[model samples]
Target: MSEIPRLSKERMNGWAADLLVCLRFCTRVPIPALSFEKSTPEISLAASAYMVPIAGALIGAAAAVILWLATRLGLPTSLAALVTMAALVALTGALHEDGLADFADALGGATQEQRLAIMKDSRIGTFGGLALVIAFLARVMSLAVLTEQSLGLAVTVLIAAAASSRSFALLPLYLLAPARTEGLGAATTDLNERLLTITGITTLVIGLLPLFAGASLARVLGALVVSAAATYGMVVLTRRLIQGQTGDVAGAVQQVAEIATYLVFTSRL
Candidate 1:
């Protein structure tokens, strides 16, 4: 381990600084001279996972603002919601979408090693291309429905869904052995307890905020219950199918969580 920085001043700042680096890595955010001493892999994973909700919150806020503007401009609610969804995808550079596609391709493979090999190929296979289309359509449809019902609720769902998806992705990090010695999976294979705790707290707070905005708390709680179940199920299934987790598995978790959130929201309506 590297020399520990002063805990009093550096701990919180270190977390924030690490999060910014992750944001820059995942998104296009330009941050300045950020450094991490040899922190535990768990810490890095948790920090990266924690950013998902924060980023989701920002994206949700932007979506809400955009929808509000569109409504004021006399656009239909569903159309406004569609535009907002497009903007969110554009902002993130479809990073998760690409992940979802790659995961789909991997899953479509006939064998475990073959699946991992497919995921690493970079070229989108037919399964991947189709999965991307379906995921996007599902997201857009869900947003449109929610916007028609309540813009505020739609925004909350969007943010919560994003955060929870990333939280779901973190489960594989905690439970699975990395498949190879490269990529994000390798970089985050040894996360620490402190980092995991931080991520859990952040994910919970973000995931529940929608409940205060006219969404039923009971339904939100139910969604979380389902998400937890799904996470466990995915972990078990992936272990059996692939012998370990990889970047594709992480992507699948996020995709499933996003869909689960939408399903829970729809049930409440």
Candidate 2:
């Protein structure tokens, strides 16, 4: 009994520490160091990967609240959806969006070396600008359509998409070698299958929430399938382009998967 209690406490402490680290990595949410620095053992980014869905859900919930407020204020559904997306971008510091831009710009390069160089440049290219505009339009339009149908469904889908997309983003980190010698992809090279499985299971629960909230089961499952396919396509493309994964590749996967998910959720056919 004593051993069981101790083990339970240790697991809880570890979980809290992991959640804090994940939130800090994925968003601009301020978490003071004093909160976890002294309370738990040092946790690696790979170890904290499993907590990403929780962090994503937190981000989505914040955006969902903004969506609710915007809609309630009598804003047009399209405008409200745009405002919600803007809040999502703000909360995440446009981290994934930046990745999508870099990835797009890299595609214009003729060689792997040139591609990597392009991704490293701070300035956006024409391709990058176009990619951002298209991605933003897809996301906002999908949310608007969903919002028009059922507010509750739209809210749940946002949370589910956010959580599942980030979970899928972890695929490249675990499945491919780093494209470079350093950076987030390299830092998380030790990401293991067990951690990914845990994350995937957590994401599944979140993804199903919309179904429980009266979303169509077939559409919800279809959304997940489409999202998974989108992430896989990104992984394959990244491997062919640069021979491995980068932080930008992971970010691109998230953005693409997110868009695919939203489109499926809003699809009528």
Best by TM-score: 2
Q: In model 1, what are the clashing residue pairs, if there are any?
A: 41-190, 41-191, 42-190, 42-191, 42-192, 43-192
Off by over 4 Å in 1: 1-9, 32-52
For all predictions, the C-alpha RMSD in Å is: 4.2, 1.2
- Each candidate structure's TM-score, on Cα atoms with residue i matched to residue i, is 0.85, 0.97
Residue-wise lDDT of candidate 2 within 7-30, one digit each (tens)?
887788889889888899899878
Cα TM-score of candidate 2: 0.97
Q: What lDDT does each candidate get?
A: 0.74, 0.91
Report the number of the highest-lDDT candidate. 2
- lDDT score of model 2? 0.91
Instruction: Report the C-alpha lDDT of model 1 over 137-231, residue by residue, as the tens digit.
Output: 78778877877887778878877887777777778877888887887778786676776777778888888977877887888888887887888
Q: Candidate 2 regions off by >4 Å? A: 34-37
Of candidate 2, the 10-residue stretch with the lowest lDDT total is 31-40
